[model samples]
Target chain A: MPQLSTFYHTLLRGRAGLLTGAALLLGSLLSGCDLIEFSPNETRTPEAYSDLTRKNLERLRQQPNPSGGDTVRFVFVGDSQRFYEEAEAFTQSVNQQRNVAFVAISGDISDFGLIREMRWVHDRLKKLNVPYLTVIGNHDLVANGREAYQKVYGPLNYSFEYGHTRFVLVDTNGREYGFNGRVPDVPWVQQALASPGPGISRQVVMSHVPPHDLDFDPQLVSPYVQALSTAPRVAFELNGHKHDFSIGQPYENGLTFINSYSFEKRQYVVLTLWGEKEFKLDTVQY
Target chain B: MRRALLLPLLLLASLLPAAAQSAASAATPDTLSLALAAAPAAEPEPAEPAAAVAPTGLTAQPWYRPHHLILQTAAGQGLITAGVGYTTLRGRVDIDVLAGYVPSKYSITPMGIFTAKAAYSPWTLPVAQGRWQLRPFSVGGFVSHTASSGLNNSRDGKYEKGYYWWSSRTRVGGFVGGKVSRVIGRNRYGHPRTLGAYYELGTNDLYLSSIFTNLGGLGVHEILTLGFGVKFDL
Candidate 1:
């Protein structure tokens, strides 16, 4: 609501006018510049995490666990891209492969996760043959986006398992306004990785802001990395938002953090976990 | 041109004999006796003059106003337009098609549009003569379908997508205006071209139903356009 009253209406006023002299002057100067997306080694706020996580965790305990059998391969995608277009393409591509049970989006399902974006994304995601879960990103907090996200995508921090693997989606995008020295809350994340349901052969953590990026706090990275590394089943930590592809070294706890590239122009990552420990990472382009 | 002049000249000459006959009858008793005897026969002679000047009002005859131009600004866009038009064979219905470019400040470069409109007024307001100048005004409704603009690659260094109704969209609205013409300088055709300024106000986009919500950096809005253009009757 603050952004609606503040920036959105102001933007509308800025857009109106018979002669848009001011907008024309301002828009021209800003269009050609390539602004920085993230700074170097920035840290998140050190403030205590909100009670919403605990409330979410308590609710998560009530949900039934997924039943597993043979190999279940569901595609992992990132970025909402152009909402419906991205959703349609992802659905079509996944359907072509068939047998996909679910989808996990890294983050940024909407540029500004307002109610409309929430509804739009929700409608598009519904087109998928399987239930899809989304992680929260910075851009998703435009208006009452937090409430909308919770209402549409369920709890921000929740875990669900399918067959032999477990998926933990967290809201690494901190408070809507500014960041402090903390992002991946160690206690909440530690609990999320602890898997309450049936034990799986692999564990994968999904978030929007990658710890490798400087925009994420340096303090939060160590604890997050430590948590993921400690899990032997945790073979991949898939994320997006750098708009580029990156693969980090095996952490101290021996975990691979793969930052997925932007989903623009049909880009996605396909991870094939063979048997129990062996795996292959393939970048699929359509 | 010389052949065109012969018809009206012949018509004027034909009226001379009738006028002379009526004059002779009015002056003599013998002529009056003959006039009374020939009254029914003489009736057709006077009706020819009325037919010669049949166009009685300003709006009665059609004028093919083939040139017009306009400059419009609204909703963060600027437009320049010009076009040509003509009247129907019956000399009452009028139609014109115009095209223009719309440049916006959102780095969405200029767009082009083509619109056609038609209207008719049964009678033109009487023109004031002498010190009593006649200020006539007429109101009629018109609808236009504007074409999407072509991409402009110069301003933003990118091709602007056309303003298809599916994309940027087009609007449908009604238009009304008044013409305050006190006849200006004669055009090359020798017809009095009226000069007046007209204003039109209208609403568009009745099909789209939008919900207004208060979101961070998001809000719903309606776009309204008000513009001034030259007005004349054809």
Candidate 2:
């Protein structure tokens, strides 16, 4: 009633109360949308929109396996930065498939490293029928991005097991850290690369910056590459920052690396795995 | 939180009738509203030219000096920011320099943002109650720089030329909103002063670009942010 009276007062003052109400309503509706930016650099996402990486991992495990038994098949895409429209299309395409267990985006989740961008990508990707995963990108390291990424996703380096495969996600954006030499965290990579006792049939590595990219620490390249080449039951490495599709053995050490297409490419990849060191790559255009 | 928000609304509601009653009794409305609004602390005002009341020797401060003290939050500028600015263009333009902070308790690195904003208010309408002046429309933009800007420039040439294009430190955006100001009383120097409550809806350059590039998929409300503030004109 008082608001109604304010509406009357606004008309008396030449159109107010309803206008005020509209403004107020819009504000309250978008209250948690990060539109009222405290600062573009701060990673102040609400609880509902945070820790998504871990949550998606749990969602990945919930999918029932087919009678194909030991085989694991999933979709791969990358670089959702500012490609919200394409992200929707990607999600739509990924949802139509029946055999896929999850979708992996190889980093550059946000273009500017802002929390809003991370949340925006999540808002689009969450519509998919399967869970999606991402590694940290160089772009995600800008400003307070490292902190923001930690808030929305989990650690820069984490590992999860699905079926017979062990997926290891690493933070290889060393140039962002001024070539700290500690990054790529050789010790951690070496430890994770070690053969886990039985039940883990295949080891897959993923990161944002490709091993051949200049952004990876020059000093750590040899060790980083050697770790991958020698890792037990290791398959091909996966990455995204390049925004295109490519598969090659850059080191000539028999270690293969595969790069996925960015959201804007109107394409994505699907990996079907069965048995040790055996896989098939299928590129789908949406 | 709800009660705190309603407090201001209730105060505005209660003061209306009192102002209307005083205005009805006085012979002249403007002088009467001014007098009643500034009443509790001073004598009833008499009709007189603003210039004529000026006493010799005690001159009004120069125009370039800041006309008000401002405290604000949000609008993508800062978490909590404070600054002072001068109004110009017949009270239509306001320029402020603000500094904002976020403690290490929340962020891994406590962040600081320095910003400058210019707002233009095109109209001010007097409410039926008290000395409230309603600014029905205000529009403006701001540029902010964060201390930890590391978006485009790699730490040690880690990136090749044209790698990441956007600057993480510098942010640009625009906002629109309204304000309510009341003639509380006079300052110690006998200068008429006002207290205002204002709000703005805003979006930064990156957010705007995201909307622009994908217009159909995004909404203006998605890009917009909100800011609330209070200012005391001296």
Candidate 3:
């Protein structure tokens, strides 16, 4: 034991040994606790990186709405998967915008549903001037992604209210579940959309796969869409996974669905909503 | 799902006793031959003189026997990993099989990762008068399969073929590392047994793909994973 201690001390005493020790220390610091990843799909995350949805919501609650009117304005984007350069630029662009309350990402934050991928996206998104939130996507459910998403963000389906709006974020990637009839949790969405607290003027639903897409469960489509259309003060449903932007009333009931631009598109929509379903869409290219 | 989880546990359970038995019966002269090749005059005096009596010629052990045992953590393998390895080519190459575990807290369910790895070290420098050894550089590759009861299969029958080209359960990765070892004692074959500590910097296939596709977007450091371990020569 004495020899071992002396050996270590001798090794650390030399210039080369000092350099090696310094390099190791620097590497550990640079990688943070994330350097020792048990698995790429492992759900463990540092406190700062975990429960982001809740943290972002808390941050949003603390910051007063920049638009002082009865209006809510948020930058909408999605599919930031592996788009690190674009995310940095997106953050810079969003920071420059005035009166933006927050950023809403529809889904698909990580291409591989890996913790590091989510952390990478967060590393950039955390730089934005305003708080940002995310919904779980099909990619985020890959392998151990469900747990990873729950650990890194908060939940697969969650709702938050800010600036007179109730945002219902749900998981709609049915194919990932083998088209199991339980996905999108129609009952839960209905429950969330059905309740609007005081000062809540409109409801905005967000998810990854829209009902029309093949990835969505065909069996639950009618029930899921019906839940949204019948909900009172519903503005429009927001979706990603298509990687492009589209807005239409595909159903006979005239329920509007607004698709968002993926991060790689170098564009995002700024949605300004007020007075019930009245809203304006402005596209900003970074 | 239970069967998938059980397989790695069974494999791990089966390997330990076999490694212990091999270590017990490892009286063959081949161990000395490799030790001599590694360190010609580095032999430490034996604590048990009865175990040091050796035949002159190199007699090979059973092919299935491993020369060393390994325990490691991280590097996207598992929280704790244990394995056995065979060193060959005068200690320049090592081939190993390992089983690793991550608890339910870190995943949807407790996960079992089974891995096969091969490493090559081009240089082994004697340090501190051969009482310690330094392998300055090692390049290696590994393939691992993860089995968890609650893991959602990426390639399940739910999607059309090629929907997701990569398999979430399996990973192929490469690493570069260095190791430092100290001679511990003499084995039955009169070889200077060593205990070594190592560190590996690695990246998996999905990480490689992420960085390859986003050269300007993701930095090399972001895709890297680090693992640390200790190896004991039997």
- Tens digit per residue, CA lDDT, model 3, B62-160: 544467778887888888888878777767888888888999888988888888899999998988876778999999999999988788888869888
Q: TM-score: which candidate is best?
A: 3
Mark the regions of model 2 whose C-alpha exceeds 4 Å error after superposition: A1-33, B1-43, B46-64, B148-162, B186-192
Per-residue lDDT tens digits for candidate 2, residues B1-234, read 233234334434544554454446454466323533453454445345366443312133443334566677777666677666667675688777666666664455665667778988999777655446889999998887765423334333655666666666678888888888756655434444566778988888888889989978776777778887777664
Report the CA-based lDDT of candidate 3 relative to the real structure: 0.84
Clashing residue pairs for model 3: none
Instruction: Select the stronger candidate by lDDT from 1 and 2.
Output: 2
lDDT of 1 by residue, A1-286 (tens): 5853455454334212111233333334433221110000001111121232343334444533322353555566777734455555666676665444555678776554433455445545556555566788765543334544554455777776655667788777643323454566768778877754445777778898877765466667787787777755676788877766778774555567777666564766666653455566666666
**What's each prediction's clash count?**
16, 3, 0
For model 1 chain A, where is the 10-residue window of minimal lDDT?
Answer: A36-45
Kindly list the per-residue Cα lDDT of model 3 for residues A1-286, writing each as its tens digit. Answer: 6975576576565423433344344445544566788888798888888999889999999999888777999999999987889999999999999999999999999998888899999999999999999999999988888888888898899998899899999999999999889998999999999868778999999999999999999999999999999999899999999999999999999889999999999999999999999999999999
Give candidate 1 regions above 4 Å deviation: A1-70, A175-177, A195-198, A250-253, B1-234
Computed on alpha carbons, the lDDT of every model, listed in order, comes to: 0.47, 0.75, 0.84
Tens digits of per-residue lDDT, candidate 1, B1-234, equal 233224334433433453454346456434323323342232232323344344333343333224222333221112444444444434344455444444432112233444455645344454444111133333334333322232211112121243111222233444444433334322223333343343343333321122122122122222123334443322
What value does the lDDT take at residue A240 in candidate 3? 98
Whose DockQ is greatest here? 3
> DockQ, in order, for the candidates?
0.01, 0.26, 0.37
Model 1 accuracy (lDDT, Cα) = 0.47
